[model samples]
Target: MKKTILLTLLVVSSFQNINSQEKREKDLLTSRKWYIKYMKFGENKREISDKTKNENWMLFNQNGKAEITTQGIKSIEDWNFGKKHEIINISEDGKFTEYKIEKLNESELVISRKYLNKTTTLGLKK
Candidate 1:
């Protein structure tokens, strides 16, 4: 009976460790910001509008304040993992454009916007 209890405890401990590790990895990956690589309209390729590549950074304070930044735009985003795990926000530069979180996976995010005459996408760096 003692041996069985020990085995069960060991198995439970192992599962706990795995669960914690998985959660940590998920949190780390989810906190990262993803940018757009290319934008296309039907069959045409749009010019890359983001001039400063290194300026892009996704900020997550873990307190519900998340922002994604690039050259001339800084967006305050809302992330909801239960329903949609992506950065959704608007430009802070007064461009009056709406932004959407296009794709967010383990290591990347794709952000996009539609303005008066153009649609832009930015590829995020990890």
Candidate 2:
């Protein structure tokens, strides 16, 4: 009986720890300002443009809407928040793109698209 009680307690504690960790990660992701740093694709690329580093913001509205914007490009994104918050899709002007975001660390996010065949790593701004 004592052993069973101890096991149950251990399991509960483990679940609580996991829940806390997941919550922390979600908060960090939601609070961060993400930016882009573009780079050339080929090996013999001459110079990386200084203009590549552009400031971008991801704003999450109260109604579960997300907007990502840079200088000239603006996209409206959809998100769902439950145990985990996920980016579902983005529509820029009239074109639609599907994207997924994953937390690489507390300060970094990895965003990927299948049709675009691209993945971008964004760093959190202090």
The number of residue pairs in model 2 that clash at the backbone is 0
| Tens digit per residue, CA lDDT, model 2, 4-123 | 999999999999987787566556656655554332223222332335434355655545467676654767776544433444355555555554664445556655544334443333
User: Where is the poorest 10-residue window by lDDT in model 1?
Assistant: 79-88
Q: What is the C-alpha local distance difference test score of each model?
A: 0.57, 0.54
- Report the Cα lDDT for candidate 2: 0.54
Q: What TM-score would every model get versus the actual structure?
A: 0.43, 0.54
Candidate 2 TM-score versus the reference = 0.54
| Count of backbone clashes, every candidate in sequence | 7, 0
- Residue 88 miss distance in model 1 (angstroms): 0.9
RMSD to the hidden true structure, all candidates: 7.6, 5.2
- Determine which window of 10 residues in candidate 2 has minimal summed lDDT: 39-48
Clashing pairs in 1: 34-109, 34-124, 35-122, 35-123, 35-124, 36-122, 36-123
